[model samples]
Target: MSATRVLTLNVWGRGSAWRRRLPLIRDGLVRIAPDLVGLQEVWRKRSGCQAERIADGLGYHVTYGAASSRRGCATQGNALLTREPVARYDVLPLPVPDGVEPRSVLRAEVGATTVLVTHLTWEWEHASVRHQQVRFLADLTHLAERRGGRDVVLLADLNAAPDTDEIRWLTGRMADAWVSAGSGPGHTYTPANGFARKAREPARRIDFVLSAGPRAVHAELAFTTPVRARRRTAWPSDHFGVVCDLTSDPGAP
Candidate 1:
């Protein structure tokens, strides 16, 4: 089986200097050149989707799934980018409780593998809601495994800390790339980020790359550099990205 390099990140939608950040995002992605990329908070307009804009001239097959809509634009959601051709694509809408934003998972079939991308509810008080969403994702993964018998890579900006019940529940079932291979705290959401500081969230590793059938070999944070432009400094997004290398797990079920 072929090895896969996976990257997962939350693009922060169109918030806070997105126009300036988009160029840096494109450049950073070009350098990393991941085999598969899962993006959350991607914005789409009448003109085109953010996935298409990033995939432009990059040779990646793009699939986007809308989770919510903005007033002036069409929608915003999760997206999957595969370097190879995708055999199939599907979108699964997730549960949306009262006062919570919509969310969905983007699924792509590449060769013999299945990749699922999603973003869960963000508020710290929304743990219960995230729990439900995690259950849904777990079911989806199991169903896909039964249907395809293919390797599965689940990527997301889950918005929960590592020690949180939702995260613990998930890592117990699947291999968390960062836990297995990353050094240091592996905090993706840091107060050091100019864009993230406004959110008042403490430094935490809420984003994840998980695999059921692939062995995580190495993992690191990406797009951590802050770029100064037009008298302002910003990282590619409010959250850093997780990049991981995965090899097929021969004994995986």
Candidate 2:
């Protein structure tokens, strides 16, 4: 096993000014130069798509899982952009609640590491759904290991706080990349007006890059800077992005 750098973020989708922030997203990702990146809320249109656009700019391999298709001409989903070509991979539709937007996971291998990219149910109303999704994610990671891969990572936007059952369950099973190699609370989600909302709720860290291997994954706490757009009218996304560097343990199976 060697070294790997992974990043994950919710790209804010096309629901808003996706076009305006596209350059910021591309520049931010290119600046980090991660080996692989996982993005939630990526969109696809007839002419092109977000992942493909960024992949083209950064020269990274692109893989996506469309959760739904609109009128047969448009699509929206999660995506994986890797510096190395992804040869083996699959898109899995995750188990969802009775009536909610369908979700999915993209599993791919870049070189020797298996990366699982996904976005879970959002909002308090879907907490139980998130719980189920977390358990399923745990099962999926283990499944990847059983399939002959040693280094496995989960990049996602879970929409849950750190102490909640969902986060506890996930960090309990997989190593939270930030725990070993991050500074501060690493808050990825914040209220629209953080100062005004603190009385009700503080910021939360929901986005993550969790990794598990038969052996240790050395992560340097050098810097996991959150990329924030400086523009007033538009920002990179509603949530912040995390950038971290990880090296696979030599003894990894």
Residues 58-128, model 1: lDDT tens digits: 88889899988878678999999888888988888888787788889998888878899999998878899
Question: Can you write out model 2's per-residue Cα lDDT over 1-253, one digit (the tens) per residue?
Answer: 4556777888867745666667767877767777788998888888888889867856887998887677687877889988778978888888797778888888887766788999888878777889888898899888878887667888898889878988998899998888877777777776542221343655788888888872224333212233345444555676777766676555443
Q: Clashes per prediction?
A: 0, 0
Write down the TM-score of every candidate. 0.95, 0.86
lDDT of 1 at 110: 87
- Runs of candidate 2 with Cα error greater than 4 angstroms are 192-202, 214-231, 250-253
Against the reference, the lDDT scores of all candidates come to 0.88, 0.76
Clashing pairs in 1: none
Task: Give lDDT: candidate 2, residue 40.
Answer: 89
**Superposed model 1: Cα runs more than 4 Å off:** 249-253
